[model samples]
Target: MPGPKSNLIDLEILDGMPDGIALVRVDGSIIHMNAALRHMCGVPDEPGEPLKLESLAVPDNIAQWRRFFTHAAEDGGPMSFDATISRASDKFTFYAEVSFHRKSLHGEPVIVATIRNMSRHRKIEEALRLEESRLEALLRLNQMTGEPINRICDFALEEAVRLTGSRIGYLAFYDEEQEKLTMHAWSAQGVKECRISNRTIEYPIKNTGLWGEAVRQRRPVITNDYNAPSPYKKGLPPGHVRLERHMNVPIMDDGRIVVVAGVGNKPEPYDIRDVRELVLLMEGMWRLLQRKQSEDQLKMSLAEKEVLLKEIHHRVKNNLQIVSSLISLQSEVATPENMTAAFKESQDRIRSMAMIHERLYRARDLAKVDFGEYLRNLTSYLKSSYQPRTAEVQIDVQNIMLDIDRAIPCGLIVNELVSNAFKYAFPDGRRGTLEISMRKDENGILLVVADDGPGLPPGIDVSNTPTLGLQLVHALVGQLDGELALHREKGARFEIRFK
Candidate 1:
């Protein structure tokens, strides 16, 4: 007889064990079985007494199990066997490690054996194999579509169908402004419809459809059965007739999505692995497209600038030639004294206009002229006409820059004033210095040409001067739409205010 507390203690240890355990007699009859073993063997009730060990034998690998058990029983050693077992008409595979050892309890020999359920371990192994297959498929998808935009897009359509095990698939891009999904390309069987635009049909990219939902959520959505009534099932447009299993995901570049791709008519539901790879392929594709557009715009601007420069050079050259011809023709017709004066004036006028064009065409920047350089050239030309020994004259010019429109008039004004100074102020061996300074005041530009020679002849009013040069100066100054003032101190000072 056994104490009730002692029997409960033994039962508690059997129930607490993680692995299944059973005990057998030397004759191969069952002695005891733990709760783990009973549950694993599908024996719902506890054993009231010892039963035959054959009841728990795994049918598929019974011979192997029997051999291992038989050897363990005789040799009192451990043996391991992988077997499939039948319990209540259901078969389960297991990896079993069995050890048979003789135990002396009050001088009676007994064999204690342990068994464990390996069905969970087998399931884990199967799952790992499936995951590896999926990862390999993704790697192949990436490799096939990584060349550039054109090839990548072509490969993407092909791989979409291949990876999803689909017979037909369509890739489309959403035009958000147009509210349409334009089909870019499609692949069916071993051939792809490279004329994606032909297969393309417009559809609203609203929140209700598969494509719209993917874009709105910035994620992938999959439908395993298109015909079934489910939340994922959204009505397709007229052209999407054969679509069964469908998948759509937003393609993003630097967090901004310019397009969405929808793959449909796949044999099975698409997975996250496919979505991730498609996004990677599209990132490269979109980037290249953007770069191509920018390059095209840059080329366009360069061509436009070249055309404009050529046109400007052509017009300036033609106008300068026309003016030079008119001036030469005018000089050929006058009498000797008048002819000499006419040629000189004509030459000076042509030279003034020529200087404008010369500055415009020769300058790296065409918008403005170097005023100091223009003045020096003009003054040097005019000074050549005067004999150096006739007057000890000095010219002081300041450097400045002005645009051609203002520069032409400004140059002519300086030429005329300097000529007048040489002709009248320094007449009869008088020595003098001419100071030509230009400065900008708060109100306007100030042009000053002062000569340190004999003062203006007594009682000669510059406003009503009879000399042609002074009259020409007044007329040219009036043409500037500005005011002119004359000062006679030590010599003569002419100041013009371009207000």
Candidate 2:
């Protein structure tokens, strides 16, 4: 039953308002429908239009609408609910928000409903959800730091396929200069279903077909119709996954394509948005690859340095054992005077070798030693060793540098020459000067050690000298592949020059 004549609503104002307006009675019957509501419900606002709103509900929702209207009438003040109404042409449907109020029109009260289609709004919400998932996928990929490159690429491919609504995907690493690529990662399911026997298919871009056009054109390529005839089409190899639709996006770094991210057989055609999403993921993957490579290189460099340090330790241990053997032999000297001198000489030699290793151990660069510093330490030690005689002996030396191989021999030579001068140069409480100087000359390095107190006996062959100190000086000079000269001017002096 419709509302009374006096209960009619003035719907002319609402007709132009872009919303569906309708008036109903308390018994689930229609009193009036404006043009918008009429067009929305597949009903005409004319003579013999259906009086009952239930007449417009589809068969499955008829009882649902019956209860909905009954409840709204009982509330009688204001109410709103979501609904789907069939279109006037019955071709499709529209989702809408239906609201109604109890209002007095003229004298009697009726229900007024306003219907606004929510189809577009629902679509916008869905689009936002899709974009959110895409961003979430990228974030998940980025958070996989320290993971292996292949594993990260696999995850990226999976997300690319999933977010782009595709059945399969692949990420291929590109050689930008060579225009070549090797398939590196495939969607786990995509690889399982493929029939191709050669998984190591490295394709040159020039020889590739539709899929390679992305690199060729340096842009994203979409093939909505994969089977269409085209000049760039290359027939698929046997066991290759069939493609109904496909898209490829090239990830560029420094203006060169470094990776090509491709997805195929999407149920729906791909678009620019898919290109953008794939580019984001692949670019992130490229950064991960770069980081992994740098980390690997650093690991390799550290490993090499570790090996070098181990070798240096081994050499030092061997040399220290040799010095230990020499000290053991010195313990066997027969006479007390000779034994004391022999032990002192052996100890000085040990100290000299030990000092070089100590410097190497403490040095920032293990490859070389500051020979100047080594000389100063040696002279100070020699002066301390021959104490009680005098603290008045003056030592002057030059600055020099040499690597471990040459520095060791030079150190031993300095130890012997400087010790001999301190022991025998000054006699009878005489205080004198010992001068040691080194310089780079045209021939090589010129090392001179001289003391003004005394000179060696004439006609003695210095090269074949029987004394251990002079023998060591001659041997060390030979080790350096150099010439040694004895000078008798003013006092005893030795000049050793080596390259």
Candidate 3:
């Protein structure tokens, strides 16, 4: 038991503490209270009578306080809890952290209670949680790349309404070419039950109301009281949802307002933080939309180029066919055997070049030709033109690819060498076999045209041969930057190697 002096010192210490301190009897009647406790309870400086602790508790919390006191006394242990307390005069409510303990005062048991206000700390925690949620929403928006613009806009609008605790949200895109704004996506929480039908809301942007003001100003617009009369006010359409608080942010691109985002009917007035969050979301969506548009344009450009290339190949092939036909006509009119043969050789060369373009027109990859298939087709044409009665042409070529630059010259070289073999090496229907082989190794391409018949005329110098065919072969070999060799042992063998 504390004596008079000890009790006075304890009262002084309790009064000096920051937390509200109160002493209550076992029945919950307040025996004594410090200045902090008196102020928290809204008690007058000079009370007419003692006040009960339960009186300071709001109606809903009175029973909870009674149960807490009973538990503290029976358990003989300190108890900590939280509750809302209200002042009786104005019914003002405040959250508090409270601790209770059974203690002996003047040989009688009493409950000592301490109260600490938690309103400020709770507000800070709530704000941090909200900021965290907004950051997560921003991250989700950034990850939606490559999606269609409409889908991205819808997601952004939905997230804006959800993050800002608004009932409805919409995103509109401006068509610069048409000089108009169109709503692309919208989300409404209660459209089914509301007076407004979502279908009726679709319309072009008009120069009226808050939305129009945002577009004209090209900045953010916020209104806490949308019902207030103003010069800019254009009354809402019939069956439209009533707007109490609203906000709109413009999405700018290339120094122009390309998109507008708006939200309305939030429980509380919109603040700068809400505007900032909505702007961030809209900006992210705009970037994604821009990227999707660029990808689509690139695809269209590539397709157009592909069509143009095919047309070019087709025209070139047709022109080369015309040149081949002219050569054929010239050969038919030539009287001299030598002049006719020269004209025929020129026709074969032109046809060989034309075949490359024909293959390119039909191929999926127009840049390179399937040289193996081209060689097979060329050999068939040469055999048909020369009419080799007894000699059979055999092809041993791998499936090799060459670009047009290399393929055209290579085709001419084959035409000249093979025609020479047919005319000179095997004469008077000489029965023999002609082998044509092409292969690619680490050393580069190797082409060999050989015949098993009488050898070349004795001492015929291939490097300085007078024959037009051999001279043409030499010139084409140099053009290909290739090494050429002539073998005249059994028949004629022409081999060329080029990188």
Query: For model 3, how does the per-residue alpha-carbon lDDT over 239-312 read when each residue is reduced to its tens digit?
Result: 76678888999888998889888999899899998898889888877887788778887887689668767777
Cα displacement (Å) at residue 214, model 1: 1.6
Q: How close is every model to the real structure, measured as TM-score?
A: 0.38, 0.53, 0.56
lDDT of 1 at 193: 27
Best TM-score among the predictions, by candidate number: 3
lDDT of 1: 0.65
The residue pairs that clash in candidate 1, if any, are none
State candidate 2's TM-score: 0.53
Report the error of model 2 at residue 200, Å.
5.8
The models' CA-based lDDT, in order, is 0.65, 0.78, 0.80
What tens digits encode model 1's per-residue C-alpha lDDT throughout 244-330? 677767776666556676666655467776665555555545565566656666777678558657777676786576466556555
Clashes of each: 0, 1, 0
Check candidate 3 and list the clashing pairs.
none
* Model 2 worst lDDT run, 10 consecutive residues: 1-10
